[model samples]
Target chain A: MDNIAGHKSGLSWVTNISVVVLVVLWLIPTVGLFVSSFRERDQISVSGWWQAPFSVELTYRTRGDGEVRPVDGGYVMEGNIFDTGEVRSSFEGGASTVSAFGDRGVAPAEYPAGTVAEIGDGETLQVNADGTYIYTSVEEPGNRGPRVYFEAETPPQFTLDNYRNVLTADGMDRAFINTLTVTIPATVIPILIAAFAAYALAWMDFPGRGLLIALVVGLLVVPLQLALVPMLNLHQRLGIGQSFLGIWLAHTGFGLPLAVYLLRNYMVGLPRDIIESAKVDGATDFQLFVKIILPLSFPALAAFAIFQFLWTWNDLLVAKVFLPSDDASKVMTVKIADDLLGSRGGDWGILATAAFVSIAVPLVVFFTMQRFLVRGLLAGSVK
Target chain B: MAPRAGFVSLKGFYMPVIVQGLLTIVIGVGGCIGYFYLSNLLLDKVIFPAKGENAGRNINRANQIRPWLFLFPAIFALGLYLVYPVVGSFWRSLYGRSPSDWVGFDNYVQLAASNEFQQAFFNNLLWVIVVPAMATFLGLLVAQLTDKLSWGNIAKSLIFMPMAISFVGASLIWKFVYANDADIGLINAIRASLGFGNPIDVMQIPFWNNFFLMVILIWIQTGFAMVILSAALRGIPEETIEAAILDGANPWQLFFRIKVPQIMGTIVVVWTTITILVLKVFDIVYTMTGGNFGTEILPSYMMDFMFRDDGRATAVAFIIMIVVLPVMIWNIVQARKEMR
Candidate 1:
């Protein structure tokens, strides 16, 4: 018994370790973007985002101002290694604090930041904390200045500049509002209409209910891409082309199958007794639905609402097809891809910030109402 | 008059586009609400006049008509937006680019003969196979692993976080990981640290880049699989596991022989649901590679032809529908069975 228990516990340890490893692996990509969004290109280029929380080593080279002049009885030229005037200029600029310096190419940080290291031939290199360095050598070091190797400790940096740039300059703010414009009505209208349909399917003794339910199920997997060109052509011919009204109706039509399916399933699960008793009490079907059914079906409605909201909000293809390609009408997903991701694909900060901005709302919705979201997923799929 | 003749006049009315948008919402939602409410009222009060002689008979007639009144708006929208377009696309597929040219099977022939179409068809096949299986497997694995731990919910939440992110957003996130700059891309950074020289642009490579794009979907979908399968895992009765343990079965044996057999239904559900998603996958390929370098899938391929070749685009759309039809029919069957 003891041997078996020991092996079982060992297996659990493996489980725990593997879960942690999997979670970290899953988080690494997003975390990389999250960190990269707060950093400058220079810092991002020099080191990994994992090193963001700690001090990073950086190297800088300053040109020599080697002018032959007499200083302390030797021909010498002196200047700060930072080239930005005083040593404090480097510190003030938020660069890594100089920790070590080197006079020779071999070891840049061989000497500490404040001390003077003497090479042969009356040449001495002195670097101070404020990045001011005095290189003393005879005969102007042959009209060439020594290349002072600078190694500094750059403190971890985090900034909101990327967010500011994305929101203001990259037009994400307008897209955010435009997305909201499409999402609200798209989400609400479908729920209202689908609720009626769902209620009818759930409770009403309709002849085609079985066939309608099956139709909804079959339509569930029909790729909206199939509907794209044809719908656009219809919209153009009907004069609703590239309009918000057009996109809303598109979202509504696409969202209805899942909405009706989920709501009808939830409504069907309502205790038969309550509905029967309500009907017997002389409450009309419409009145019972408005009062009893709608209230009781809040959780399901909420789940579907979140699903619709996230679907509409995170949607790119629907917006691409239905909404105008013009910037003024584009939603955040489309706008971000068009303005930032396309032209400045290499600008990690802009891309990360824009991507994060676009996803932030759905993330908030997903976390705050995750219970309903999961409920929706389970009911929507499994049934 | 045509059915959308009223909409034709509304579309031509002069107004700011935003006002027109708000008006549409008011008109559209208001129209649906008004239709259901007024239609019911009309049926009860005006058409049937339930309070007159033979009131009970009048009420019966109104009751019989109420469900249709409630269902009319939804049916109209679905027919106009979904049903009509489906039939229209099929019809459109028979004609050439201008829709005036009478082309019989020419579009399908072109789609079958084109090199890009063949690559897209096969690549889509690869995606449909690989994404669903791998995502479901990983999800089941995570669900099983996390179920044994105390902090499982947190782990699950973190793993599931990608679900909230859009495919475009996810593509961007993974783009950073697959970045060609050794200093920027996390994958390349790790590679460089291990002395792998300069970064290799993973997306530029043919064939393998398709898998790189598929990883984004698997990343997003695994959480969905985990959540559903986790619920299924918990649904397993305790007596089954206890009896297996009593029989001195190992953990692996307990999982495969006991747990898996019980949850096979949920596993299939997750697999097919993901398969449906895989068929419609566009944004990942659209944003990541734009169907270039042999990464083209059917949806992206269709999208490329959408602006130019209407027949070919519609033909591609039909091809996608054909691929999705079997699973869709299976889905409906399963749903009907569940309903029963």
Candidate 2:
């Protein structure tokens, strides 16, 4: 009884703190990728995502590409260090002010910004806060531009270029559509087939029904890895090799055990009086299923649909084994794993954006229908 | 890519993929609806002739045959896709490259003798043992800790978010976390910030790297365990907890003694579910290290041999199936008991 009311004990504080810590620990990795996706490649390489909002120090070694022009007295080679356009995109908000500039490699930031430094060869290098540099030499500088080294403070930058690159340049757009093509039919066909089958199992009196149920329970854990070589060979012989149709059928087969199990369990529990009354009215089993059982079993149907959708959508091995490797047929998971992350492991921008794209759809489905999902998991797993 | 031999070309037709996709769906859904409607119509109107003088007998006959009619497609699909594959894999394991020449148990013998197979076998053993135990333990701890808090659901959802991510996506996320560079990766960035000069390549450390990869699955499956076990905990009878409170049981004693025992059945279910997942763990290792640096498990190893060596690949797959069979039977037995 003492535990019933809120006593405001020290345990409450502990629980609060522990929950905060747990949430942060869980959120860190995913949040890290989300933040990294917006950053430019060089910025992601130079600093951690946690330090993104702070001013970043970037070291650039840029050569003045243009000829040396005589401005006032001495010949001067004048250009901004961020003139390369690649460096300009790193400063997201605006041009970052140069904190320091140096003429030699030993000390790239030897001279402070807005200060003039004298060199031993009568060459002076003066840099402004905006990364614009002025170099004056008493003698005529060579045709080649001098290497101007500067350390500048750049504002944090974010862009959609990574998403652009993945969707257009890396073939993720086609993969997304291919995933949908595989997923829609796979999700739709199983519900109808399983629903009909489940109705029969739940209501009809048939010999070996219990044995068939047991067999399904056994098949639930049958690893689809065993299906790879044999099924591929089967598809090849049947002339359905590596087509969208083949993949849809593969997904349907793999998803059926759970679908039938869940729907049967749900349908078996429906009020028996309704089905008895329908049968008394001389309604056939098909009529009873369509008019009564199907509508009432919406929750179970929804639960199985989400499971199949997420399962088939997230599947990589099935698609890899059953579908052809043509650009037209690759799914997002296969493309992201095999083509993008495999080769461009160091490209965080593309990798993060691509990963997020693949994860986004199922996440939306999960959040929107989490109630049915939780119900399905409990019913499917628990007694 | 090599042009697939002996396959019919659907390329000459210039239909958009979206149109083709929609057409297939229409055909598939239309065919399913058509079959069900026509079959039922025939059963009621033509075959049994329910309106005749022998209506009772005809109805009985249709009822007796109706379940089979409904079950035919599912059975065919299950037989072709699942049961047939199991049998086919066994058959393929007995034959040579082309299946004409016999190689009975020769692939199995060679697999047992190979060093790589041993490495993958031991690594799989490590995963099967460690992932379920760790994930279940963490799930129970989190579920217990977060049960009474105001923000518990939100906290649970945060932990549960990884479940929606594909293994490939999760691998990429964790790879970023375990990135070798000191600047981009979170782990090495923290290390470098703390004055550790050299960054550790976490995926390259043999033996322990398997655990590192297992962490991803653990992270994903813990939320599932938490959601299920949390419900199971709530299902524990209130009188038992109240009685423990009256007996002056402390918090730890209350949880481990009263609560844990009550939900032990659920704990076993969660453990076995995760065990099944860990046995099939492939995509993470495949994407993260491609079985390099001693991170190979059973499935990834089987995939490596799939196109190159048929007999050995089927044998490896059969090995995984054998490993899974006992757990599968245990699951079915538990479910059957629940049914009654």
Highest lDDT model number: 2
**Model 1 lDDT at residue A238:** 82
TM-score of 1: 0.89
lDDT of 1 by residue, A238-309 (tens): 887777878888999999989988999999999999999999999987888889999999999999999999
User: What is the per-residue lDDT of model 2 for residues A14-93, given as tens digits with 9 covering 90 to 100?
Assistant: 87898788778888888988899899887888888888887688787766665588866678877776774445555555
Off by over 4 Å in 2: A1-8, A64-74, A77-93, A102-122, A128-132, A142-145, B1-15
**lDDT value for candidate 2?**
0.85
Candidate 1: where are CA atoms >4 Å away?
A1-8, A56-90, A93-130, A133-153, B1-30
Tens digits of lDDT, candidate 1, B55-105: 999888878788887777777777777777778888899999897998988
User: Per-residue alpha-carbon lDDT of model 2 for B174-209, expressed as tens digits?
Assistant: 977899988877788889989999999999987898
Listed per model, the TM-scores of chain A against the true chain A are 0.82, 0.91
Task: Score candidate 1 by lDDT.
Answer: 0.83
